[model samples]
Target chain A: MGKVLMKGNEVLAEAAVHADCRYYFGYPITPQSELVAYMARRLPEVGGLFLQAESEIAAINMVYGAASTGVRVMTSSSSPGFSLKQEGISYLVGSELPAVIVNIVRGGPGLGNIQPAQSDYFQVTKGGGHGDYHIPVLAPSTLQEIVDLTMDAFDIADKYRSPVIIMGDGMLGQMMEPVEFKEKVESKQFDKSWATTGTRGDGGPKIITSLELDADSLEKRNTLLQKKFAEMKEQEVRYETYCTEDADYIIVAYGTVARIAMNAINKARETGLKIGLIRPISLWPFPEKPFEETRKRVKGYISVEMSAGQMIEDVRLAVNGHAPVDFYGRTGGVVPTQEEIYEKIITVAGGLKYEHENGI
Target chain B: MLQEIIIAGFGGQGVMSMGQLIAYAGMIEEKNVSWLPSYGPEQRGGTANCAVVVSDQQVGSPLVSNPSAVIVLNNPSFDKFEPKVRPGGLLISNSSLVARKSEREDIKVIDIRATDLANELGNSRITNMILLGAFIEYSKFLSENSIIESLKKVLSEDKYHLIDINKRALRKGAELVAVF
Candidate 1:
């Protein structure tokens, strides 16, 4: 494959076009501002529309509006901005619209920091927007995955008839990498069955609304969505395991933090610590199978992240108390160093006896 | 084993391009590779950095923390990253941009005025190309022929004519450094 150097933001924009997304509505936010800038330059060239909405709220609603017509549509924003769009996101999820949302996260409980931070882990995976619904979240650590997964996310969203989110930290958005675009997939077979296109066949007028009067019917719809989510766990869960079979300790992380953790794992191996990494590419599915397998062999586990320790909860749940799990992080946009992780691994090795008590 | 590196500098100095060429050379040598950069805010008006990982096996991480080597094009970058290099590693700094030297004597330092050399050669834009020359000369990271052959694949079509000048720049830097 020929590799062309491209920024992650630009690549995602290109991926959007490749996915046949004809409408994009977004506002400028740190780390992800370039996605909009890229779409502004590219959308017109591909006979698409790029709208700079007034706010994240307006942008997401615009996505809602475009998605109603069953056209591929997308929007992207950073963490705090993403918070503002939650109301609209919940609506999209409830209404079951096929749209792509990108969260190139910056640090924040509220406007934290802009440098790369994975603090939005709980926010993205646990339905940060609102309601009891889930948006399929894909976490890409590299620029190429940022492009490829974005293409996949569009299809996944369309297949499930729901909103899909490509969630990542600032590092993924800001980094440029060599990426080769897939030969454009022509998704000409549009399903107009539920779309708000002009009425056809036996219908006088079709309505698409989240408001249901019957509780049982609503419960059934929600149950169906839950089943779809279960299917996602079966069909879409993805992760990469490095040296877990021989690992004494497995460092679990996602997005940029996972990339750094791999380097630390390599360094630790030199010092005779058999540390490997469990990088979750699909953050929501959580990749329970691999973690469950790794827990059988590894002495202990460490949750490495850019946040305080969000994904550790999920890691603990996946491992099911089979082994001990610990946490290490640098918050407020600071990333953990290889040295820091090495120290933690050494500590875990030194205190291996503590594994039975609290998982060193 | 794969070694990842981040080379940072001001725009127009070809830092990102230099990193790309190194990563591309690794690909040409049949090694798995990735070249990544901080482009949006960092590449616009301030400093720019690209992370390049070259590996014999599948690359798990594309970001570099303790790189085997670092190519610093300006003072801010040198001051920022010099402390982060692994012991006994290589740090190539642009002498024109820095007034201070590396603190660690164990880490080999090659001081080349790549900016000045590129200016003399017609465009300061190729300073990164000149530094890329030093990087190859000192490290033996890739064969000279391999680099020359891969330049066209990395550079844009309009900029392809400058390949000869860059090769010359690489050779000049190699001739100056006795890293071998």
Candidate 2:
């Protein structure tokens, strides 16, 4: 198909449609409202369902109901809206229903501002809901990547029979770029025989419930979920490395921050600094393997983000004391510039020599 | 090659559309393009801006800090972004609205009477098209034909009638800049 310039949120909505996702339920929220608006206009054209729930809570529940019917379903919201849907998300996970939840994140501790932010990193990757469960989180850096990952999110959600989160910031949601909607992604289809799609002609009525009053049954369920999570960690760690072959310093970032870090890395390299970047595409399965491999060659690591420092904790854990990890970030809707990131890298690289000389 | 531009103006001045046009034209020319608008509560009646990046390679950041070029339509926008233009960059200002001229010695500043030209074309809203015309002429980032084609795509079918006036504004702006 020919390339069409589209906003990030609109492209994601289109990608979901192209991926055969028919059921969409969402509440209006800034940064992500366009996704819902696009779905509202386009889904009906394909004889698909588009619903705008009264609230984020109601919307996520609709996703749960639709997903249980063996239909490709999704719900989108911003940071606060995502928080409202956390309970529903947990229920979806516990019930083992496959659904795609998109969080086009805006700044927040609570109604902070309506601007792009990566502050929801912890909320997304560490299970925002109250329960022992994990959702595969995909963080896309570019508009095209958002389209590709939105399609992949559905397949991944269906593959594991779990809820998948597409974590993007307001920047990713609003920016417009050229995109080509290719053919639907071909993947192994999940067996929906277990789905609660009514008992007419089926062997028995499928029960889709997250409630387990028995302790032993609940423990077993937890064990099975943990096993699936471990499998995902082994199988689904997506990341990208730039100019790390002979680099002494590596900056780790994700989503929009990763793109800015790339520009900083390029600028630093021009000044003879051996700087590289590690961008985590799959934020949940945090691409720890790359850090393990690069720890030997790299001097230190810098974690840059739009938040104060959320992903830096993961970076430090991944580096495992092999290298000193520093962080540079902006909080409350402030985006860091490449020049600021470049300066931070230079300062961090300078400190590395001091630490070596002190030997303590 | 990468061309990073910032288009700034009042809310209803079509600043966002101007940025979108450049980005769409870049796409038609087979280049990677990203257009990011300054979105928030301030988007209503306040100073609005958008960053447009056209590159042969994938654009890293949609936000342009020190842009290679800046198009300012009003006084506040000109004041805010004039100093942010990179050295040896281009600054296209609407002289009819922004009374002050950019004092930057390093960058090339071209002041076009975009609003006045659009008014002469019988539509004041096409002032953005006039500024876009001057930008294309000064930068040569995209062809005039490509921009006209992009306008057809960007404008809705109902607004197709305004295309002729917009094209005229674009040409007049280009010709005005050519005289200098």
Candidate 3:
């Protein structure tokens, strides 16, 4: 297949369809509206269902219902819209339903304008919907990675029987880039034995509910869920590191900000700063291995973000006092410029001697 | 090499499509390309802009903080983005809409009367095409054939009839830059 220029939202929708996600329930929201719009146009052609529900709340419950029927299902929304879906997400988690939810993040504490921001990192990777559990989330920076991860979200969802979140932002959702959809690996296949598919005439009864009256049984279930989460954390960690082999300083970022950091890293490298970037692809799994490995060697870590400071905490958690973790951030939709980030890098490494840092 | 560009104008002035065409053309030529629009409440009215990156290698960031070239179809965009052009970059403004020269002395500026030229060509809608053609010619970093090929991919079939006029506008643009 040849590469075609496509917007991030549309490509993500197509990748979902390619992953055999036959049902989509979503309400329109800025930035990610194109995903729902594309599904409305493309899903029916592939014999899939596209439903525009009354509200974000309605849409996520619809996803829960469809996913319980053993069908691949999804829902997408931007920041304000996504907040309304939180209750439904928690319910899906409690039920262990395999579903893909997309949050094309926009600026916000409260309808904080319709611009791109990564403020939802904590809400998404941590528990947004009142739960003691965390969900696996993929934050893809580029359109091509969006394709790979959107498709992977389904497999990961089904494999773990948990909702997978694709954490994108308006910058990624609205950007157009050259992408070639990969030939799917046959969705990896699933039995879905616990599905609520219609009962055969004489088949035994089955129930699909997250409500458990007994405290003991619920605790047992929670323990099993914890085990599965542990497995996912060990098996599904994904991340990318650039120029980190022999670095004196490293930058930690994800999604759109990570790409901006890369441009800054390149400029900083030109003027003799031993800098690198660690971009986490899977936000929940968090990819701590790189941080653990690089901690003893690097002088400090710069955590850059579009929010006031959400992901920086994760970087700190991973670094664990091994090095100084500095933060640079912008909130409410203002993107950081490369020059400013480059200047920040120079500031971080200004007093350190380059030759001694390299141990020459 | 990477060409980081910003194309800006009012909503009806084809700013978004101009950015898309550049991205599509870059893809057709087998180069890495990205198009990022300036999206906010302003998109509901007033000015619109998009950043385009066409590079020999994968683009690190689609957001162009400083552009190698800028195409402003209205006075406001010219007023806004002219100062952000990289020192040795290029500026192509719609002289028909904007009445001032660039305030910067470090960069090259091309004052193409794209709106007037398109009107002379019997299609005011082709004003953006005229500007795109001039950018390609003046930059000489990309070719006209690549853009003509991209139109077929980007435009709907119903609009295919306008390809001839668009081609002419492009040619007229290229011709303008040749003698300037």
Give the number of the best model, judged by DockQ: 2
What is candidate 1's lDDT per residue for A1-360, written digit by digit as tens? 466667778888988888888899999999888899999998999899999999999999999999998899999999999888888888888888889999888877787777788888887889876668777789988877887798889888888888988988887786655688867656646465888888867787777778878999989888988998888878888898888878888889888777777777888888787888888888887789988777877777889998888999999999888888888898887768777877888777767434454643
| Interface DockQ of each model | 0.38, 0.88, 0.86
TM-score, prediction 1: 0.88
- Lowest summed lDDT across 10 adjacent residues in model 3 chain A is found at A351-360
Give per-residue CA lDDT, model 3, range B64-101, as digits (tens): 97899999999999999999999999999999999889
Best first by DockQ, ranked:
2, 3, 1
- For model 2, how does the per-residue alpha-carbon lDDT over A241-352 read when each residue is reduced to its tens digit? 9998898999999998899888888988988999988999999988998898998678888889999889988998898878878788998989999989988987877554
Ranking by lDDT: 3, 2, 1
Chain A alone, TM-score per model? 0.95, 0.97, 0.96
Model 1: DockQ score = 0.38
Residue B134 shift from truth in candidate 3, angstroms: 0.9
Provide the overall lDDT of each model, using Cα atoms, as 2-decimal numbers.
Answer: 0.82, 0.90, 0.90
lDDT of 1 by residue, B1-180 (tens): 657677988776778778878877887787777776764434455888888878887665566777888889888889888898888888989888877788698788889988788889887777877787788888876887878877887767998888889888888788868743
CAPRI docking class of candidate 3: high
TM-score of candidate 2 chain A against the true chain A: 0.97
Off by over 4 Å in 3: A201-203, A352-360, B43-45
